[model samples]
Target: MRENDGKSIIIRRSRGWIPINWRDLYEYRELLYFLTWRDLKVKYKQTLLGAAWAVLQPLFMMFMFTIFFGRMAKVPSDGVPYPIFSYSGLILWTYFAGALSMSSNSLVGGSHLISKIYFPRLLMPTASTLAGLVDYLIALGVMVFLMIWYHFPPSPGLLVLPLVVFCGFLAATGVGLWLSAMNVEYRDIRFVIPFLIQLWLFATPVIYPVTMLPEKYRWLLALNPMSGVIEAHRACILGHKPIDWISLEISFAIILLIFITGLYYFKRMEKTFADVI
Candidate 1:
């Protein structure tokens, strides 16, 4: 901390419109933790299945995909079984999907806290995204059991799983920012989220491997950030091939773009949140 003439100088705005204070976020890290914990507990509070629901959402989706796509349509999995292939990717997808959807609504959901408190507004959605990691890890545990049941050895490329997951986090957080800010002013944004995710799932290589698509169409898949994330997950988990560095790079680039632009827009609109909501 520094002071000029005993009056602390605070950064007033980012560039011109966006407002960001990294120091404030660091100072309030405990609030972030409490908010994340609250979200996790609230999610499982009234449910009989409790944490098991986290494992089951992706697990059952895998079962349906296996029965339909694997058995009936004969979907290709790049030399791996469709169930484990889909399950591995689903572990990540389920988390991103939940986090994005929840984060989009978080600001509105926490309107009471937002109106009363002076905490960093970004913390709301960021906490929601981090909270979903619990479900993601539970589903990942199920994935490990599935791998053993299918006798699939860990891929050497599994070393890169952390990188892939980080990309998904960035993408989810980025989209969450934009959506949450928009949702405050325009409530219909919430209705669009479910439909958006449905279309997005088909766009990503979840039930089928990237190789299952035509060569020309494959190029378009990279435009969907999750496409690369899911593809990298499959590659690293099943040893499909060396990591698709090109797609992974493209995904990272998009994640960065989304994060920057989303943060900017969210901050730009943040001044209107209390008044508008």
Candidate 2:
């Protein structure tokens, strides 16, 4: 409270779902920075492998998929080699899996701050999601090496790689917000996230080409947002096929719907966090 001419003035946060205080986010930007940095440090603090885990996680998965799916099952990669094909998909998939896992647990993990302070609860999940970008960049470097080793040259479509990554970010952040808010009250969401990620991976064409499915059934893939994002990544990075705009549009629509609803749900639930936590 500030005293002015013997009167006190009070400021309050707008509680409505649509009216967010953007100024508050801007003011707390430094706190977001600290939270992101802290998350990165804490994630690798005691690990013997440290940051190498980022590269190893996806790289090892690529090897396993290449051996089983590429060699045994003879999974088609739309003419792209199996190892690079799977590794490219794994780069984005790993980031999304990590982002979704960390962000969903962020609120419960930071319960101490929630009970003791008045900062935007959204920052907890946002920081958690952003911190995984460090791992994404590291894994992406390995992808570059694979592309060179395989003598694959990127097409002009490669320029759209950022858009594909952003779509994945939106999908992860949307699901993260919903799960984190619900996890604050229920606490069971933590267990469900791993299962959800595993199911989602098979639903997406990460290990195989979407073309293996009949064209009549291909429409169902559009319902899965990562399907378009991962497919777009292959088209851009591998340059074997044109980007699937129709599927991508549908995916974007679904992602936007999820993101907006998640924001509203998160805001609605945050009011109870300090007390419940």
Candidate 3:
């Protein structure tokens, strides 16, 4: 209970199937900012390379992928240079993967805070995903450098890059909500997250183009939301072809489904977090 003036406010656990209290979240917006900033500080603290690890992680992966997938396997990049092609996709993938991983573990990692505090539990994972944007922006600098070296000029499609990125963020946040809530109950979730990320990386089109698959099989890849996000990034940044509206529409629907369902699930699980954790 908190005291305001001479009055006391009573805090009660939410009843069954309640919708998210957007007002409550808004009221606690400063807490969200604090958590996000704390995550950023904690992420880079005591690291020898500090923020440079963000650039080097994706950059080195791009090099290996360029050699193995681009050179050895002769992967098609829609005529864009393989390095920039792979790097562009990698930057977003790196962000999504990091966001998903961090958020999945957020609740368990913050167990002490969860047990002691009255803040919105959703803020934990939300801040985890939001903090990754710093790393995302840092990695994008390497992409810009690669684009310049490869002589690939930005296209008008760049206008929609933010939307594509939001889609990726939505996917990460949605999955994080589901996994983080479950992780509170099942400790094994932490073990599964790394394997899940590895599989999801291959499922996404980070190292190859969707066109590499036959037309009939292309729909399969489109079913994965990250495919559309990555392909749209290539369209916007590489200017290979016009954006694929149909695929993007499908991806948006799936991402929306995941987000809405994840929200309900997280809220349903929220009441039990303190007890379970």
lDDT of 3 by residue, 173-221 (tens): 9999999999999999999999999998999888988778888888788
Between candidates 2 and 3, the one scoring higher on TM-score is 3
In model 1, what is the error at residue 106, expressed in angstroms?
0.5
Q: Cα lDDT of model 2 overall? A: 0.90
Model 1 ranges with Cα > 4 A deviation: 1-15
Question: What CA RMSD would candidate 2 show?
Answer: 2.6
Q: Could you report the Cα RMSD, in angstroms, for every candidate shown?
A: 2.2, 2.6, 2.4
Q: Per-residue CA lDDT of candidate 1, range 89-152, in tens?
A: 8889999999999999999999988888788899999999999988887788877888889998
TM-score of 2: 0.94
| Cα lDDT, model 1, residue 59 | 86
**For candidate 2, which ten residues in a row score worst on lDDT?**
1-10
The count of backbone overlaps in candidate 2 is 0
Q: How many backbone clashes does candidate 3 have?
A: 0
* Cα lDDT, model 3, residue 117: 82
Query: Model 3: which ten-residue window has the lowest total lDDT?
Result: 1-10
lDDT of the candidates, in the order given: 0.89, 0.90, 0.90
